[model samples]
Target: MQFQTFSSPHTDRPNSVDKVMLQVILALLPGVLAMTWYFGPGVLINIVIATLSAVAFEALVLKLRKRPVMPTLHDLSAVVTAILFAIAVPPLLPWWLTVIGMAFAIIMVKQLYGGLGYNPFNPAMAAYVLLLISWPIPMTSWLPPAVLSTNPLDFMQIVSAIFTGSPPTGLEWDAITMATPLDGMRTNLDQGQMISEISQSPVWGDFGGLGWEWVGNWFLMGGLWLIYKRTITWHIPLAFFAGLTGLAMITFLFDPESYPFALFHVFSGGAILGAFFIATDPVTACTTRKGQLIYGVAIGMLVYIIRTWGGYPDAVAFAVLLLNMAAPTIDYYTRPQVFGHGDNHG
Candidate 1:
């Protein structure tokens, strides 16, 4: 009798790319809710427009490329990219701007590069940068936080403002619009105001702006949840914060009058979200442990540098894209040697 070949049983797990993407989308809900509560219905409208546009563009591109559309659309990558793009952009921006940005993100950045795992840049960041460059006024026109707004916009007013560039009541967009904390800081610094003076302004509260600090903290909590769920590792977040804090501390020590404190850097702008969610993106980020640390630290340092010295008020998008370009090289250099490989002493 011939001996029969033995086969091991397949390991069962509930994890999939789609499931991971869904979890991330769920995690962003709290932050999105906070934004809507503070920023008004405009944010929700932006989300809807961007998400639908991204999905549509993704499907169109896939069909044009002769790829299976159903499976790819079900992956939820385009949805996540769109949501991130919407969150980063000004809620009151023109509806067409959102459509254009999402289309570029899905068609040019994500799909043109061969889709999800093949893209070398963060799709959302790429789209955000494109919009910012193309529409400076709209991109920068952020509404004052609800706590500070004299007249908070309703849903219809928001829709009208976005589509017509004016509220239904004929209110001027600039009256409701105000510079964000980071934008204020950048402008003040450019005007030769010291950090201490800028920090004392009405625009900045103890930690950050009126409602922004809370939003950032909520995102931080969600990020911690993502780590607890093992959807992302801790290396990138920890290293990113470490680099930011370290750099800020060094500058603050040297010139407290000119530089903001470490805590401000950690709590302000997109630092929390960038560290936890954006940098932790598995596709464009480095894979090895050491490479993750290095990549994160590099991003953090670049963010600080650009915010402090460069023209941009926030540098998360630029930093992430720059580091994304280096991820492959970082991974190769930082990969751990195989167990059986002999260590070569130089």
Candidate 2:
């Protein structure tokens, strides 16, 4: 009797890469919507430009690398990366800058590193850092919330600002630009002002900055949704927040005059986004449960350190990149032993 070779009864888990990436895209929607509502149509334009650029770059790279382009394109990894990159960018950044950043992210950072799973850093963060270093002024020029803008930009006005560094009617984004909460804190601290004094500003509210707190809460909700969907575990997000809070509390207690409150740190800048979406990037982050916790905690600590002491007012990108460098080491030590393997310790 001829016997045919049999595969294992269990096929690999049915969730494809596309499904995972698509879930992430959906998870980001609430945060994206919040950002657009508060920041104006510039964010929407940035998203469109970044997404198209990323897809185009991905296809070009795949073609040159002789990879099967259709499968990869359909997976939506490029789109997700683009969205992340776009959101991280300044709302008023020039169109060419957006295009250049997206190209760098997709080509040099993502595809050049052997694409998706093999990239050592978060592509979006890498590109963001590059842009920050290259164009410090433009990268930090955030407009005040729509409520505060003297002339809230329309779609074409936003397009004009992004392409020409001036709005359609010659109103520069600088006229409407206001410091982000983190930036405000950093500047105030440098000027020897106390946190309590800074909190009195219109930019700040009870928990954090007015618009920023709401945006962070929305992202937090989206993160919880991801957890509920079983798309990610709670360990990383919980650990990240705990780490940030612990550091912030220590510093705040040491001298509340200088340091902002823990809640402020947790709710401002990209902390929520980093905690949920970026740190939980499955391909680049630690894989084991314990490793993920350690990885997230490290990111949180780095974020706090960089924000408090480093040049940048926000450090999510730097923190995430630093932790990505440690992921392999984290996984190695935290990996569970095989079921039948005897303990190696003598």
Candidate 3:
């Protein structure tokens, strides 16, 4: 006698890797366009350069490892990684620096860990952290929004700055670049200034920094669209914002002078971008539904804690990396039992 046998049930998802990556690229358009409008064309330049560099590096690595090259590049994961990494860095980051970061992300961080689904951490965040640590000065030199910029460089000037590290003939670096809102806030608070007084600066907008909040809003919009399209689930993002805003609200209620309001925290820096894009990375994030909440909330809480008390003013990259290390453990504990094989919580 023979018994018919089949493997466990597995749903055939219609979403392919390339399709998902394409959707993500489309989702980023609104935020990217907003950033270009506010800041300048430097961001678009970075994206172009980083994308080319990332694909080249990815191909190089695959060739070294005797893997099929076109098949991997066709998936568009490398382009996504490059774009995410590009947006995280200063829009005017030097071209060589951008290339270096992409190489590190694609080769050392991604491929070294067995690539894509096998990677334990988000390559873009990891690359951002590395660049920030390695080039503190260049990494922090963010351009003020066009409205605030006293000397806005034209396209040629911006390109010259990235490639040659020189401003226009009449403009100095200080005239073109300014500290980010989060960076400015940390500096002022360290000098014992209250939040109320600090918020009086010209950089302050309704809830976040001038121009910066609008960019955040666009990213939030794009993220919601992704959720609506079912490109990504909402579990991670909802829990992440809940954790971040909950902490901010509590602290601000106690001492509004010391802490910025909860809404400010949500819109000020990388909070929205990290919540929707960085933390939602399927490969590095938790797999099980229950585990995703724990992973995201933990990252959100860590981001607030580090930004508030730790040395860094913006802690998204650090927080994401820390939680990436914990995701596997979270998934292991949260794994569900089979319908017929019941289990109880320990």
Q: How does each model score on lDDT?
A: 0.88, 0.88, 0.91
Clashes by residue pair, model 3? none
Runs off by more than 4 Å, candidate 3: 1-15, 343-346
Q: lDDT per residue, candidate 2, 1-346, as tens digits?
A: 4444467754545538899888889989999999998998788789999999999999999999999999889989889888888888879889999999998899998999899899998989999999999999889989887766777767776777888876567555567687888998899889989877888887787878778888898888889999998989999999998889999999999998998889999888999998889889888899999999999888888889999999998999998998889999999999998887867756
Q: If ranked by TM-score, best first, what sequence of candidates would result?
A: 3, 2, 1
Candidate 1: tens digits of C-alpha lDDT, residues 110-146: 8989999999999999998998787888888999989
Q: Whose lDDT is greatest here?
A: 3
List candidate 1 segments past 4 Å from native. 1-10, 167-169, 343-346
Residue-level error in angstroms, candidate 3, position 202: 1.7
1 or 3, greater by TM-score:
3
Model 1 CA RMSD to the hidden true structure, in angstroms: 3.4
